[model samples]
Target chain A: MRTLYHLALSPQSRLIRLVLGEKRMEVHLRAEPVWERRDEFLAINPAGEVPVLVEDDGSTIAGSQAIAEYLEECDDTIPLLPGTIADRAEIRRLVSWFDRKFDREVTDLLVGEKVMKRFLGIGEPSSSAIRAGHANLQIHLAYIAWLAERRTWLAGDKFSLADLAAAAHLSCVDYLGDVPWDHAPEAKEWYARVKSRPAFRSLLADAVPGLRPVGHYADLDF
Target chain B: MRTLYHLALSPQSRLIRLVLGEKRMEVHLRAEPVWERRDEFLAINPAGEVPVLVEDDGSTIAGSQAIAEYLEECDDTIPLLPGTIADRAEIRRLVSWFDRKFDREVTDLLVGEKVMKRFLGIGEPSSSAIRAGHANLQIHLAYIAWLAERRTWLAGDKFSLADLAAAAHLSCVDYLGDVPWDHAPEAKEWYARVKSRPAFRSLLADAVPGLRPVGHYADLDF
Candidate 1:
């Protein structure tokens, strides 16, 4: 059986899960404390990154983008990536843009300062970092809104990996009530569609021990 | 005729030049000051990054990996990337490993502190950043050395995109006298092979107007 070694609430992990769910692929989710670097998980992913997928054929895949591509290659039906070479490249670029750039600018600050501290058994969240993350997220969401406003999906009419990538980042923030949904109604509406998906249900149900979800986290209409 | 939109001093551009030259492909080098963001270049690559290839057929390719893949697709002779899907994935992963991570930890620091300072007309280097960068460089170079000590090439036997990515970052730092070639013997030897290539001659000739080459940069035998 295929198995995924993942951390709950990790955007990349969630993105992979969403893609797998969309594909209707059956894979056992083995929650891995990526930050803890357990020896077994480290053996699987030397980078100690989350969302390492182990294929039934026994080929281990690391990197969320790589895993997604590998899954697409393994199964042809219900493609999550955009169609056409150009379109694929566009979507990949957007996915990368969010995964790397936006994560650094927005999600990271929030997660590291707020979520990580709480997980590490540290005290209260840093107000300044929270404020900074909140501000940055608004800008990021506005950009997403602009992109969402123009295309039926992030790349085009087809729901591609870009949607999963964007949702992965957004959902993490939304769980903490960090997303200013009012800033981008279209983006929020898109998030609603994304969160309602069967794949996302698993993510919504995830509880990080002491990290309680914001009241709006489980609300489909919120 | 094939044309390369490149920053002359950029080793990534140099790597592309070498690949083009090795294939005996005649390419007109069109120096693109990426920082300037000219309208023409922006139309070619919205990201405004270097090594955008404008093929004779008027098709434009962006991203180093994308350009390389296109090149491999266009011409199968003198193959750069390794064969097999797994090998291709491994090569791409390594290419990204260096291109993104190492660039941030190593290249960006040296370039920003040294290269960008001169280009942007900023005076004096940030000693603290340089000290921090040097420490980071040692760690990165050690990993490269370890990898080089084991594999025939960065990714495998074939000179893949990983080599180009590594060379791109190293060459920039080498120009700035940041690379301690004397310390990392394995990486240094690998650099010798990369540098000795006839295709690398053009790269060695690159000279930024206000910045002169560090003492040993052009000494191929060094």
Candidate 2:
């Protein structure tokens, strides 16, 4: 069986998990405390980041994008990046948008301050960062609403990694009850559709020990 | 001819430029002052970032990774992501390592502070950030030297996108004359090899209007 080293609140880790579930691939999940910088884990991924996948043959694939591409190459039966070259480019562009831009502006601000800080014993969460996170979340959610209104899914007709990448970050933020879903109903509706998917089951059930998810986090109709 | 919207010092933009050059694709480079947040550019890329490639047909691909992957799919004649699935994963891992990690620690600090700040007219460059950037650069250079000593290229025997991504970031920092290449001879040797490639010529020749590159930035043998 394949194994995945991941963190509960890590959007990148959750993105891979969703990708695996969507692909119908079974993976043994192992929680890795990346902050400790474990030597053994570092040996597998020099980046010292989570969501590193180790195959049965001991082949290690690090980084979410790398793993996603590797999986797409290995088995394209359920392509998360489907369509023509242009279509695929749009999907990847959205994926990068969420992974990099969203992560920096919202996820890192909220999750890094709220969850990661507590786990790492870093100190109190900065209210300023949390405030900024909420403010930025509104802008992103509005963007999501715009995309949702235009396309069936985030990228296009099909449900793709773009949606997963987005939901991954939003889920992490949603876990903290930070997302103002009510204010952006269109984005909320799209997210509700994503939430009902079978692949999203495990993520909704994720409890980071001391940090319990918000009241409506697991609600499929959220 | 294809068109690429880019910033002079953006590592992401430079990565795509090198990728296009490697694939023997001719592109008309257009410098986009992303700080302006032009509504037209935002429509092409909601993220409003650089390295957005527009094809002759007006099909647009945004983001460095998306553009790189699209280029590879369009033409594999000079594949930058060569080899097996595992090998490709390794290459992508290194590419991400430099694109995300290296950029965050070094390029963003050095270039963002030194170049972007001046261009944006936000404020003066922080000496603290430049100090941290220099410190981080040494660690990354040492890591590069370690990898260079072990493999022919950063990812493996083949010179892949990993090398291009690393070089893209280092070249930006080098333009500021901040890279302490003398401290890491092996990394310097590896960079020299990348710098001498025909694909690197355009980048070497680039001179921002107000700022000049280091004396050795364009030199083949330094």
lDDT: which candidate is best? 2
Q: Rate the local accuracy (lDDT) of all candidates.
A: 0.78, 0.94
Question: lDDT (0-100) at residue B164 of candidate 2?
Answer: 98
Tell me which residue pairs clash in candidate 1: none
Q: For every model shown, what is its TM-score relative to the native structure?
A: 0.85, 0.98
- Ten contiguous residues minimizing lDDT sum, candidate 1 chain B: B64-73
lDDT of 2 at B54: 92
Off by over 4 Å in 1: A56-58, A117-130, B1-81, B117-126
Error of 2 at B188 (Å): 0.9
TM-score, chain B, each candidate? 0.91, 0.98
Q: Chain A TM-scores, all candidates?
A: 0.93, 0.98
Please give, as one word, the docking class of candidate 1.
acceptable
